[model samples]
Target chain A: MLERTKKSFLTALWILIITFPLMGLKTVFTGEQAEVGIRADAFYLAGVVFLCGMMWSMKGLIGRGIAFAVPPAKSCTGAIKTSVMKVPVWCWQVGILAMLCAFPFMGSEAELNKYFSFLIETLIYVSLALGLNIMVGMVGLLVLGYAAFFGIGAYTYAILSLNFHVPFWPSLFIGGAIAGVIGILLGIPSIRLRGDYLAIVTLGFGEIVRFVLKNEAAVTGGEQGLPNQHIPGAIAAPSLGFMVLDREIHYYYIAIVIMVLVVFVVHRLNNSRTGRAWIAIREDETAAMSMGINTFRMKILAFAISAFIAGFVGVFYAARMNFVNPEAFRFEYSVLILSMVILGGMGSVPGVILGAVILQVIPWLMRDMMPNLLREYFPSAANVAGTLTDFRLLIFGGIMVIMMIFRPQGIIGNARRKIELGVEEERD
Target chain B: MFQHIVDGTTQGAIYALIALGYTLVYGILGMINFAHGEVYMIGAYIGIISLAVFTATGMTLISLPLCVFVAFLAALFFCAAYGYTIEKTAYRPLRQAHILAPLISAIGMSTFLQNYVMLAHGKDKFDFPGIFRAAFINNTVQISGARVNYLEIFIIAASLVTMLCLHLMIRYTRIGKAMRATAQDKKMAGLVGININRVIPFTFIVGSALAAIAGVMVSMYVGATKFDDGYMAGMKAFTAAVLGGIGNITGTMLGGFILGLAESMGIWLISSDYKDAYSFILLLIVLIVRPRGLLGEQVSDRA
Candidate 1:
């Protein structure tokens, strides 16, 4: 025990040895180029050292607490699965549909606008997460550049509509098709690579897409961005008695309808033979190939299908935003979408939706809704409220780390995925 | 043309230093330390702060080199602690989890650190003190119709010396042998009584320390450091690691130099506006054509 304590202290000593120069010197020495007014404060140095030591000492306790609190993922997910199974599928579906349809009528303009906008954004991310789910969850390909497809879809639609005057409805399919083609192009090379290599390739491809979009100024309008995108209104002539889908509520319904359709299709696909092939590939590629799954074709198919959905969302995204920029599609966005899939429970339809909603809505509530509510009581809250928006990523990263450590299977984790995650497979 | 080479060499040296962190961590753990870049960023911040402290104390009045040495040491120490802490908090928990878990955790660490620093420091670039203000570094020499700054010479020499020391340590040191053994086979190494836990974090410490040195070098060279500086530079170094076949130290060095020269020469040959795209493009091509990279031996089929 004494030896172990010595070792632990030595570790702390090592940390202090490194940290002393970085923090202590900063507080004491100030900086080489600092002006005369600046002076090193002893208090700050003491505080930094104390903090470091505290963190170092508490490390073991924290690790143990986290480890102890985190129950095996299998049990947690099994509980979720059983509870979900108790509810009739059709009843839940109808209930969701009713709630969505009545959402706009629930509140005033300010409230409705906020909820409607939040719902729309959440639904868009759902689609993105669902698309990523096919690759990461179903097929087990870690794509770090999934947002490139999202961008591709948006750009294809923007360029086609802006240049060729393509109609919004047709442009949506065309955009999706173009994205699918790009996916296939990417897939051909990626099929040979596995895991981290595939991730790097996709990441690189994403950067390439962004650079091309940014550099090809004539087509993408460069940094100024392509603006004034055509929004889809009235499925037909307004005189035919159909409502023109120009309002936020109309957009909300349209987005929800699309989301429901995507969920349904993804659910059906999950049960299909192709989905089984994907599962096989995910489980063990070599085994799946030997079993004659045509792993390459399925992988490409997954990529294409995933890209198609992203493209579909991209059209609606462009329409809703009424503008498109290369900046909108970045590598970080891909990570965000990927997080939704992973956090929700990879390879599970309901899991992805839950993940998307939770991740998106939490940030929305923290950054926008919470501040709005808080500022109503405390007028001075406005200044601090704005900074909450800046902390969004910090919170996001913290959640991801905590989630991975505590609940790797996610809130609504798939059983197979739990197994893949190395959670002890509980015999139910 | 020669000036581009000189510039490329300095940039490449820094990239090599950063790449060593990536390669060392990857070699030991079989996981890409995505947050390694953020660790470098923290080092840069520390470098700036330490310089301010030194200047405040009038330490330059004593000896400029001594002052700079203290600042570099400070940055190195803090970054090493950050690196070790990150491993303990974000990585250790997910060591036995699926591959994606650690990667996600790393991404989270990266995002968290970036935002945390942004919040603490405010979202503005800080000016870095130029440590090497001596007559040698202040002057430039004409080489093949191009001006080569003495600072560039210093950067190259510093990078080479660091790499040499690291190579010697890894080859001759007891801890280095243990690290190598654990990297080769963790279970087997443990069976042979090697302390896996200590070895892993130690690897992180050394790798992070190297990154700190690189970070300080970079800030000094550029005369400024920003919150997001780590992301692009990290990506470039990551590219260099992959280009040289990740986990191979010598290959990482070669990859860094090659990437640096390629970017410099490519900009000269073509356009500078898309300079950032060069590394990504090279990474894609390499992964597609030769996943093993220039000097990477066969990575086990598992990863």
Candidate 2:
């Protein structure tokens, strides 16, 4: 108990140290303005509180204070196993704390808020990448229409929350449940198919969803989209003495919490029986079947679970953005998310997070930063050459090519996954 | 509805040409060559550049035939080089990897190519010079109140000639047979001393050339081309290829015509804004009922 308490204390201390600069800087920078400044100050305080809670919980791991509290292992394997199990939990606490602290800093500028939105968007992709990692990465299912689930989630939330005025949290769960059903329906066809055939079939299913959403204008709001819905408040009480609930900073934390939850759940699933079964099926479906695994059921489970997670994220996205359009849930989004999973280490959790963050945040950052720098440095050239948004696709495309050529395993790839996924073979 | 048929056929011919490239590449490499559409898009930009340069040189009405020929060659060379580079850089490394690697790389390359073009030429459409813009014969040969353009006849003839050439190339040539052999069994052909490397590049050259011709034809017909045209057009052509049979050349041609006809009729029946929805709906139904496509052979899992 003493050791655990000490460890928790250190984790709390580390979070405080890491997040202090951002909190301090925000208060200093935004001191002049009254309304926005006060709002920013409140956001920073909330961030500090959340960070403190996170750090307190993580102190044992960060400070090695729980070393004695850990049950003495008889073998090296046991010790290593325990350490491995503890590492991810520690990482999650650290990540959540970092995100909370970063939220206030992100809201310092209007432009930075867009990047923060993108960061939240990245969290959504991380959710997707984790979910897809189960299907394509673990189960070896080549799903070309993963966006169908995303659309289902988005449409479900939009219809329920917008039309019926249902609360965000309930609508979010319903959306996930609806998407889960759809995923199961789609997975039935997978029983008879494999590889490219399965891919094409999923592609068809995805297109069907897209077309239906496009044509069913009454239910979906069609091309015009469902818009202007206010973001749901976190607390029911109106007299909480804090009004950061509707702010972008508050939404950022909501996304961060959702992302952390998703990561935690997926991480647990990865180490569970289902994740192992998925790996078995991925390695060899025939072998998995020979081992008495119901391969069909597993594939369907993988699809359903992945879709469920995607739908969960989709709800948050709709609420945060307060908009849902068919165009937003295009085939390209599916492909892009898929690319994030593959380009990152396929089965590696941290790799998926890194991929999601880089792909989502980097482009937006570049979009915001590059054009202004170009304009400021070369005013005359900027007039004639145009901004980065005009040429953003080219630069983004170049980055992809470079990544594919140089590091197919992605920025934070796993070595074992690299070999298993055949990334090494491709490198050769 | 003669005009609809004419317009549909013209678009169908363009799709057919691009689909041939997709089919041929798929047949040889067993890969979708998703970047093929971008190659077609690039060809249109090349044609635009060629027109701009030629027009600036005081060439008033450079015969449509000569202009098209030049555009075709320029597009062919540029796109062929791109195809060769893509194969060498993106695909060559992932040759032994899971099929997903190459597919993802192709997507990356697709985005890269589109973005590259968008940057080089602004995001908006570039007008094709008026050399082939005018209708040859504006007479109404009405089937049911729709007027037909005689210029569409030229598009059909061009498409036929390109198809016939491709047919002959695959049927008669030694390299063509080598491509077929390589597609059938890469290792066996390599052991038999067929240079798979040479044959693959040659396939890309032929495929990209056809796509270039299609791009020029599309520009001539549409009167303008955009940097992002490849994505929509590519998706349509891919749909056409899949609708017929992915690796079957002749099936792709039939698929293109069917898709074009279906799209035109569907648009006429419904709203034009939902034309994409119509094609995708048809594609979905076809995939669900006939996953192997109308003429595609069953693909065996090798990896």
TM per prediction? 0.89, 0.80
Candidate 2 predicts chain B with a TM-score of 0.92
Model 2 DockQ, alpha carbons vs. true complex: 0.16
Candidate 1 per-residue C-alpha lDDT over A31-115 given as tens digits, one digit per residue, 9 for 90 to 100: 3346434224333534555556667667898888876889575688899989988999798889988988887777886767867
Which one wins on DockQ?
Answer: 1
Write down the TM-score for model 1: 0.89
lDDT of 2 by residue, B109-163 (tens): 8988777666545577877766445545443355567766665777789899989
List each model's interface RMSD: 4.4, 14.9
Tens digits of per-residue lDDT, candidate 2, A1-428, equal 56655654554454344223222221111121111111243245445555566666677576575455554534667878778768775886797678666657744567576556666677778888888877878787888788889888888887776567676667778989999999998788554566665766677678778877877787776677775333443212112244535566667677777877888888888889888888888777778889999988888898899999888888777777667778887878888888888788687787777776677765775676666677788887675335566656656766776676666556656555556666444321
Residue by residue across B1-303, what tens digits does model 1's lDDT show?
888998888889989899999999888877889899999988988877877766776776897777778878988888888888998989998777766778778988999889877765668786676554444467898889988777788789999999999888888999989988987888889999999999999999998998999888788888778888899889889889888988888999999998898889878988997898888887778777787788988766664
Chain A TM-scores for all candidates read 0.79, 0.71
User: How high is the lDDT of residue A3 in model 2?
Assistant: 65
